[model samples]
Target: MSGNIAKHVFVMAGTGSIGLIAIFMVDLLNFFYISALKNPSYTAAVAFAGSLGFILSAISIGSSIGISATVSRLIGAKKRGKARRYAATFLAVMLCIATLLAALNFIFSRQLVSLIGGKGEALEGAVLFLRILAPAFPLLCLVMAISGLLRSLGEANAAMRVTLSGAVCAAVLDPIFIFGLDLGLTGAALGTIFSRILICANGWYQLSKHDILAFPRLKEIKPALKAIAPIALPAIATNLATPVGNLFVTRTMSHFGNDAISALSVIERSVPICFAFIFALTGSIGPIIAQNFGARIFERVKETYRWALRFTLGCVALIWLIFFLNQNLLIKLFHIQGIGIPIIHFFCDYLVEGYAFLGLLFVSNTAFNNLGFAFYSTFFNWGRATLGTIPFVLIGFYWGPEGILTGMTAGMALFGTLAYFKAKNVIHNLHLRFPEALA
Candidate 1:
C-alpha cells in the first residue's frame, strides 16, 4: 500500500495473470485434446458444456468479488477480526449456494444442453459431461472464496498458487484421461473435477496459514449476509451478463452448423488465454482500489484506476498484434474447417481490437464494484449484454457468423466507452464527498 501505484498494479496484475493464464491455457489444451479426436460432435458438445460451466463459474466469481471487496475494505480499516468473520461466513454461504446450483444443473443437464441447441452425440456428450462435473461446483466456489481472502490479506502469490496448482493438475491429468484412458469427453470432465479438488485444497491451506478463517456463529450469519449480498447479488448479475450474451451467440451459432459451433468454442477458450492479463486485472485491482477507498485515500484510488487503464491498453495492443500475426496458425492449431476457418480468421483480424474497449469496461467495472456503485456494474453489463448485444447481433445476422461477431464487437465498444466515463464520474464524486482527502 505504501509502494508506487503503477508498480503495485503491474506486480499484482502480473502475478495474478500467471495463475489465470495457466488455468486458461489448461482449458484451451482441454479443447485441443478434445478436437484431436477428430469429431465435431465432441467439440460441439464440449462447447455447450463449457458455456453452461461458465454460468456456474460466474456465480462463484461474483460471490468472491463481494467477499474480497468487503473484506479488503474492512482490513484497510484495521478490522481484522471482522474481516475473518466475513471471510468464513461468506465461504459457507457460497458453498450452500454452489451445492444447490450444482444439483439443479445436474438434474436438468440434458434440458439445459438442448436449450442451447445440442443434438445427437453432442447432446449426449454434453449431458454426461455436465453431470460428471456438476458435483465440483461447491469445490470451485470454496477455492474462489479462499483465494479472495488470501488476496484481501495481500497474499497475492499464495492466491496465485491456489489456481496454479489446479492448472498443473489439469494439465497432467487431461491428456492421460482423454487419450491414454480413451475416455474422450468423459475424461475431460473428470480432469476438471480433480483439478477443482486440488485447487480447493491449496486455497484452504493458504488461507488457514494466514488465520483468516473461522466458523461463523449463527448470529454472525445474518450480518454477514447483509454485508455480502449488496455487492454479491449485483456482482453476480453483472457477471452473468457475459454468459447470457454468449448464450445468445452460441444459440445463434448452433443454427449455422457444428463447424460454426466448434469455431465458437475455440474462440471462447482462446480469449482468456490471449487476454488473461486483462481478465486478471479485475481481481487484481479490486483489493487495491477497495483498500484505498476504505482508507479514504481518494487520490491513490484514482491513480490506481488510471494506471490500470494504461496497463490494459498496452496488454490489449500486444495481444492483438500477436493474434493478428498468428491467425492462420490458430486455425491450423485447432484444425478448423469450413465455416469455422473464416470465423476464426475474421475474429483474429477484425474483432481483436474491440477488446481494448472491453478492457476499458473491465477497468470501470473494478471501480464500480469496489467503490460502492455495484449496481452500475450490473446495469452496464446487462446493457452491453442485451441492448448493446441483441439488436446489433440481429442486424449482423443478415451478414452471417462474421457479421454477428462484428455486431458483438460494436456492442463492446459502446458500453465500454460509456462505462469508462461513468467510472471516472464515480471517482470524481468521491473527491467531492471527501474534499479533506484531497487536501
Candidate 2:
C-alpha cells in the first residue's frame, strides 16, 4: 500500500503535466498557425472531433478500469497464477478489439466524424487525426489494464513507471511533432498514439519482470470470465458517459455562440487540474479497498475509506483555493472571453467550493466502482448527471449558466453526502467481521 501510495502519486503528478497541458498544446499550435483551426467552424470541428476522441478515451479508460478491478480481485484471492493468465487473456482480447477499431477508423474516418456532425476542413482534419489516433485505443487500453494487474500485485512502482513514461513520451513528442514536423492537430494525435504504444511496451516488459510469469490455461478461462463479468463488462459500457456528458456540455455551450464554447473549453480543461490530485488519491485508494474488501479485511477497508475522504477533500480544497486566487489571470490566459469570465469564474468557484460534497460523491462512486459495484456506480453517476445536473442546467437557462454551476455545486454536494450515508448502511452489512475493529 505504501509503495502504491508513493509511486502512484509520482506518476500521476507527472502525467498531470502532459494530460492537463494537452489542450494548450493543441491551442498553442493553433495559435501559432492562427488560421489552421481557430475559427468558429474550426472550433466547432475541434469540439466535435475531440468529443469523439473523448468518448473513445472513456471507453478505453473504462476497459482499463475493469481490467484493474478484475485483476485486483484475482490477486486478492491469492490466485497470482490465475491472475496472470487472466491478464494474458485480457491483453489478447483488448489487442484484437483495438486493432479492429483502428482498422474501422482507417476505413471510415470521415463517416465517423460526420455522423457526429463534424463539418468542412474540420471534418477533413478529423479524418486524418482519427485514423492516426485509432491504434492508440488498443495500446492505452491494454497498458492501463495491465498496469492495474501490476498494481494489484503491489508492484506499484513498476506500474507507475509505465504510466509516467507515457506522459513523458507525450510531453516530449508534442512539441517536436507540432513544431518540428508541422503536423498540427494530427501531430498531437500522432504523438499521443505513439506514446501509448511505448507505454504498452513498457508495461509488457514490466510484467515479464514479475517473480513468476503464469500463462493462462485455456481450461480456467470460463470461470475467470464469470468472476470478471461482474466487474469488467459493464464498466466498458457505463464509462461512456464521461465523454458523452462532456459532449452535451460542449454542444449546449456552443449553441450560445463561439465565445461560449471556447470559454467552456478552456474552463473544462483547467478544472481537471484540480481534479488530478483528487483523482489520484481516490484511484490509489480504490485497489487497496478492493483487495482488502475481497479478503474481508473490514477494518482496513473502513480505515482506507475514511483516510481517502480526508486526504482527497483536503487536497481538493487546497487546489480549489489556488484556482480561486488566480482566477483573474487564469481566465485572462485563455483569451477566449467575451463577458464570460464572471460566469466562468463563478462556475469555477462554485464548482470547486462544492468540492467536499462532490469529493464525497467521487470517493463513494469510486469505492463502489472499484469494489464490484458497477451498477451502483453507473446508476448514481448517470443519475447525478441527468437528475442532479440537468435540472440545474435547465434552471440556468432562466437564471444564467452560473445558476447552473450553483446547481451543480449543490447537486454534487447533496448527492455526495446522501451517497455516503446511503453507502454507510451497506457498509455496515458488508459481510465482514473485523475483530480488530471491535477491539
Candidate 3:
C-alpha cells in the first residue's frame, strides 16, 4: 500500500500470472495429450465438459471476489480480526454452494452435456468426465477462497505457490494416469480431481501458517453474508456471463460439426496460456485497488487503475505478435485437421487481437468490483455475453465458422470500449464524492 503503484501492479500481476500459467498449462496439456490420440470426439468431449466446468467454477470465483474485496478493505482499514472472520465465513459459504452445484451437475451430467450439443461418443465422454470431476468442486472452492485470502493479505508469492502445487501434481500424474494406466479420458478427469485435492490442502496450509483464517461462528455467518452479498452476488452473475456466451458459441459451432468444436477447443486452451498475465491482472489488481479505497486513498486508487490498463495493453501486444508468428506451429502441434485447420488459422491470424478488448473489460471489472459498484461489472459482462455476443455470432453464421469467430471479436471490441469508459467514469465519480481524500 505504500510502495510504487506501478511496481506493485507489475510484481503482483507477474507472480499471479506464473501461478495462473501453471494451472492453465495443465489444461492446455490435458487437451494436447487428448488431441494426440487423434480422436475428434475426444477433443470435442473435453471442450463441452470444460464449458460446463467454467460455469460451476464461476460460482466459487465470484464468492472469492467478495472475500478478497471485503477482507482486503478491512485490512487496509486496520480491522484484521473482522477480516479473518469474514474470510473464514465466506470460504464456508462458498464450499457449500460449490458442493451443491457439483452434485446437481453430476446427477444430470448427460442432460447438461446434451444441452450444450454434445452427442454420441462426445456426449458420453463428456458425461463421464463431468461425473468424475464434479465431487472435487468443493475442493476447488476451498483453493480459490484461500488463494484470494492470501492475495488480500498481500502475500502474492504464497498465493502463487498454492496454484503451483496443483499444477506440479497434475504435470506428474496426468501422463501416468492417462497413458501408463491407459485410462484415457477418464485418466485426465482423475488427474484433475487429484490436483484439486492437492491445491486445497496446500492452500489451507498457507492460510493456517499465516493465521489468517478463523472458524466462523454461527452468529458471524449472517452478518458476513450481509456484508459480502452485495459484491458476491453480482460478481457471480458477472462471471457466469462468459460461460453463458461460450455455451451459446459452442452450441452454434456444433452445427459445423466436431471439427469446428475441436478447433474452438484448441483456441480455448491456448487463450489462458497466452494471456495469463492479463487474467492475473484481474485478481491481482483487485486487492491493490480495494486496499487503497478502504484507506481513503482515492489518488492511489486512480493511479493503480491507470497503470493496470497500460500494463494490459502492452501485454496484449506482445502476446498477439507471438501468436501471429506461430499460427502454423500451433495448428501442427494441436494436430488440427480438416475444417479445424482453417478455423485455427483464422483465429491466429485475426481473432487474437480481440483479446485486447477482452483485457480492457477485465481491468474494468476489477475496478467495478473493488470500487463499490459490482453491479456495473455484472451489467457490462452480461451485456457483452448476450447483446455483444449473441447477435454478432448470429450474423457471423452467414459467413460460416470463421464468421462466428469474427462476430465474437466484434462484440468484445464494443463492450470492452464501453466498459473502459464506464470504469473511468466510476473513478471520476469516486473522486467527486471523496474530495478530501485527494488532498
Each candidate's lDDT (Cα)?
Answer: 0.87, 0.64, 0.87
List residue ranges in candidate 3 displaced over 4 A: 1-4, 73-85, 287-303, 428-433, 436-439
TM-score of 2: 0.78
In the range 1-439, model 3's lDDT, one tens digit per residue, is 7989999899878877898897787677778778877889988999999989888878888888788879987888998899888878877877787888889999999998899899999999899989999988888788778888888887878878888888888888988998899888999998898888888888888788878788877788998998898878887888899989999999889888888999998988889888999998887788799888878888898899999999999998898889889989988887787899999888888888889999999999899988878778888899999999999999998898999999999999999999999999988788677667532
Model 1: per-residue Cα lDDT at residue 422: 94
lDDT tens string, model 1, 24-98?
766787789889887888989999999998898889888988898799878889988988897788778778878
Candidate 2 lDDT, 1-439, residue by residue in tens: 3344444544544443343343234333332232233454444455555667666666666666666666776677788777777767665666677788768767887886666555566577667767777766677667667666676667776776777677677777876776689777666677777777887788778877774346556675576567665666677666675556565555455446555655555565555555666656666566677667767776666677777677666777787788778878765555545646676677657576677776787778777765556567777667666676766666665665566556666667667787788666556667643334321
The worst-scoring run of ten residues by lDDT in candidate 2 lies at 26-35
The window of 10 residues in a row where model 1 has the poorest summed lDDT is 430-439
- Root-mean-square deviation of Cα positions for candidate 3 versus the true structure, in angstroms: 2.4
Model 2 spans > 4 angstroms off: 1-46, 73-80, 102-127, 211-224, 287-303, 337-343, 369-374, 398-410, 428-439
